[model samples]
Target: MKAAHFYLLLHVFSTASVLVNAFDPITTTVVVSVGAALGRTIYDYFHERCDPKWISFNVTGLEVDLENKLFGQHIASRIILKAVNGFMSNVNPKKPLVLSLHGWTGTGKNFVSQLIAENIYKEGMDSSFVHVFTSELHFPHPSQLDTYKSQLQQWIKGNVSNCERSMFIFDEMDKMHPGLIDSIKPYLDYYDKLDGVSYRKAIFIFLSNAGGESIIQTALDFWKAGREREEIELRDLETLLSLSVFNNKKSGLWHTSLIDKNLVDFFVPFLPLEYRHVVQCALAEMEARGLRPDQSVADQVARDCVYFPKSERVFSVKGCKTIESKLDYYT
Candidate 1:
């Protein structure tokens, strides 16, 4: 039988089984249990379908996650919350929401992406409507650029066609072949439709380590001058970040039309974590693993992380990336 018909039959059986409990409790229990298992199977089968039941944007949840779970990124947190809120709230966006997150490793680029995904789709990263591409894994061969471009275009077109609200995330963009990303430029553009498919409602996120050096240098400069890191804003880093990413040969964005055409809606910068932030990460990890937050353990883990500016040691070199493993060793 059709899945939907089966689902409806199971729903009726579950409701009717509840009534049977008065006559035969054991039979009713078995019927209810079997109905529930089949119902779950049916739910998973249709989970990927594009509809309000499966996908809904929760702006407040996203804000809370970014504020509570994310550490040491006031600028990134604010920009992402606003950008995503505005985009999801709009019924008719001119183009797809494009976010290019740049930062040193472990500074929460990937984490922020996960938060966004969780808030938008019930299944988060596991949602079929959400797609992720890694540079080294997906497009490791420069010689296969032509083949990769064709496959990528088809992949995106196919997925977007399946669901207008699909999300695409590209990780390790710095290692991506320079021209490979340009393949999706048309989809990110403001075109109403390309061959009868509307991509305006889709979202594209690019995460990269490119332009991180400039971000670190700026943060370092601010620290050296004794200015509060919170005082540093997007204006101080946005322009510099775009220039650095565009000029850096290894950055997947180098000389790409994505930057030149202003297709990237935001170039969010994640600042390096400080000693205190690393400690917070350690504590948070312990709590996540159901362990009591130990200040001593957090402190030891923070101290174990290598810090930069050899003499000053102002910022974490790994940026809380190794906190989980370190916590394992300590606890």
Candidate 2:
């Protein structure tokens, strides 16, 4: 063993030995028990554990990330902060904290999830407690929906059994088999336990482009009326988002009970990115790559992206999705 570990063990045993000789039998027993617990705590501190030592909620970090890293998403930034803060602060939640993110690609749906993971898990996305499933890759065979359902349930149950604070992110929900996700409805519902497993402390995030059209339309309408995008609020899009996702047949959430039962707590809308936001993404990517921020390179990268509304070119066609690759070309 390492010298430090050997010394720690020696200290614990020597301290216990001293207590045993100095105190009565009963007192000695209590002291030894306390010593063991302290040793265990020390060990846990040095090692990775599923408890609070490894998982902590940092609302401040999350807030700062949403404000600084994320761009052109006032409504998303606000709802995400409040929703996550409230959910994480609660000692006993009725059900798993469910957030369904709907928007165009690269609108920060995945990035927001990453930020939450980073603040909660010491390992962030690499945490064993955090699981990601891409519908197109994980559950590609629609004909095997039954098998996929079984595997998904087992996966979730087994993981939650290991760590109640587990997080599951489902990407490309629009491509998932319609009824496949409903398999885990029981876990998402308000129940003390489903066959001896409590999922109340878990978090489930669904990412999909199912409602991008409605979200874009809403933003377009605001822009046409010469209203600031910041003026757009959750109230203006929540109902529309839910309806759009529910009615869209291709959406994996299409009439899923996860929605019908009101298990989903929030349907976050990511508005399409404008030219300025794309430029911000480029600059951020540059900084992330350890390069000095160059406005000229950022502008060139942003310019390379295709914009929509041919005449006006108000919004980026691919949002900030291609910013990284485009930046590589310019830089």
**TM-score list, all predictions:** 0.89, 0.88
Error of 2 at 37 (Å): 12
In the range 1-331, model 2's lDDT, one tens digit per residue, is 4889868876886687677778988998898888788778666656766888789999999999999899999988999999999999999998899999999988899999999999999989999999999998999887899999999999999999999999999999999999999999999999999889999999999999999999999999999999999999999999999999999999999999998989999999999999999989988999999999999999998888888888899999898998888877888
lDDT tens string, model 1, 253-300?
999999999999999999999999999999889899999999999999
lDDT of 2: 0.92
Which 10 successive residues of model 2 have the least lDDT summed? 40-49
Off by over 4 Å in 1: 1-46
lDDT of 1 at 2: 90
Which candidate leads in TM-score? 1
| TM-score, structure 1 vs. true | 0.89
What are the lDDT figures for the candidates, one per model?
A: 0.94, 0.92
lDDT of 1: 0.94
